[model samples]
Target: MSVQALVRWVAAGLAALVVSAMPMAASAQQPSKSSMALANEILDIKGSLQIFETVIPGVVEKSKATLLQMNPNLFKDVDAIGNDLRKEFAPRLAVLREEIAKIYATRFTEQEMKDTIAFYKSPLGKKILTEEPNFVDRSMAAAQDWAVKLNDEVLQRFRAELRKRGHPF
Candidate 1:
């Protein structure tokens, strides 16, 4: 490349880097479309809900398996049992769905939803909304881990005290 073109290209690259690195507000930030924000929020919430949804099926399947395992003749056909359960409980799940929808509607205000949508439209906000579920889940898992440990410690202490008193361990 010619020296002038090389210098111009270098200058353009540096300018792009500096511009990208600057605060978004310093750059001419366009306002987000509320509909797009709402869509993304819905998607994010649905995605987060799906993340922890395995337990529902897992619990059901495990229960079914345990019932059959404990009593080999309890179910003539396990598949039939499962199908019957699905058919029976499917309607009830609508109740759960309504309950969950009501909870979300109550927990988040309409204005809060608008604000969240607006925030998620921003690059930083998008990053945060994307990362926050994982962050929250991990933090919660950490807290739960500690809580379990604390419960165990307390139970062990009580057990030891009982043993000291010549009660059953």
Candidate 2:
């Protein structure tokens, strides 16, 4: 390549790098503590988890029940379902925990998450977390019922469409 062409390419590369660095420089400015707290306030981990628990309930609890029925070695007290064996079942829950924590973490800064956790530590936050599981349990059960009906309707529509089009499977 000619020297002029090489110099132009280098300048273009330098421009791109400088543009990429702008976001990092702006983010490093560090939000104020009150801003962090506000972020914490707006970002609702408990509300999100309640949504989750409603969606999944305690897979561990259900699994332990199945385990006890199958083996009886686990779920000896029914409370052991929440015990160290959670690590044994960690693989199943790891992705869920990571994904959920990520939604909470990435939405806020470090100090913001800390402040959020601190709020959840108090009476109101603690209460929300405590009650959310049951509420979601009911909500998810209804959601499941709705999903079944939706699936049947979609299936019927697909079959009718295929028949009308005279498409052979």
Candidate 3:
């Protein structure tokens, strides 16, 4: 796959993980400060926050592309400004981190967060963490290939039915 396609797939997978982790309902009670702290620790141990590292840069590049499309001659200026904006907006990632932690804090209790952190620090958890990317990659590829075969089967069946009906298909 192309680098861009890989990046998009990874981004989408991470996004789906985040969405799945969220609480189903809004909580009337806010998470305690200690629970939030535990949630942050869980995030750190899981390295979930690393996904946010590209947010600022991606936004900057997208905006630069939009501007460059209108004024192609301003490439130099747009590039410089994009770099500056990346640095300027970098701190906004903290806000996203906090919001995600809040979601975790709301979904899981403080004890659960502590358990999660402990698991992540354990040997089995470490092994899973090391191997999960490869597992997910192979699983997704297998699923995609299976889907393609199933689609071809369905199309062939449809063509057979159409031919039976005197249609060219």
lDDT of 2 at 146: 99
Point out the higher-scoring one by lDDT: 2 or 3: 3
User: Model 2, range 1-169, lDDT digits (tens) per residue?
Assistant: 3434333434443464456555554454455555544444543555432223322334666666776788765556755545665656556534554433443444467766777778787999899777755554555557768999999999989988998899753
Q: Candidate 3: global Cα-lDDT?
A: 0.80
Model 1: residues with Cα > 4 Å off, grouped in runs:
1-48, 73-76, 87-94, 144-169
For each candidate, the alpha-carbon lDDT, in order, equals: 0.57, 0.55, 0.80
Model 3: per-residue Cα lDDT at residue 121: 91
Model 2 TM-score (2 dp): 0.35
lDDT of 1 at 151: 100
At residue 19, give the lDDT of candidate 3. 83
The candidate scoring highest on TM-score is 3
lDDT of each residue in 1-169, candidate 1, tens digit only:
3434333433443464345444443444333445334534554644433432333454567778998888878677775777677666656644544333333344455577776667767888878867765565566567768999999999999999999999999
Model 3 CA deviation exceeding 4 Å by range: 1-18, 21-25
Candidate 2 clashes between residue pairs 3 or more apart in a chain or in different chains: 54-136
Error of 3 at 1 (Å): 12
Q: Kindly indicate the candidate among 1 and 2 with the higher lDDT.
A: 1
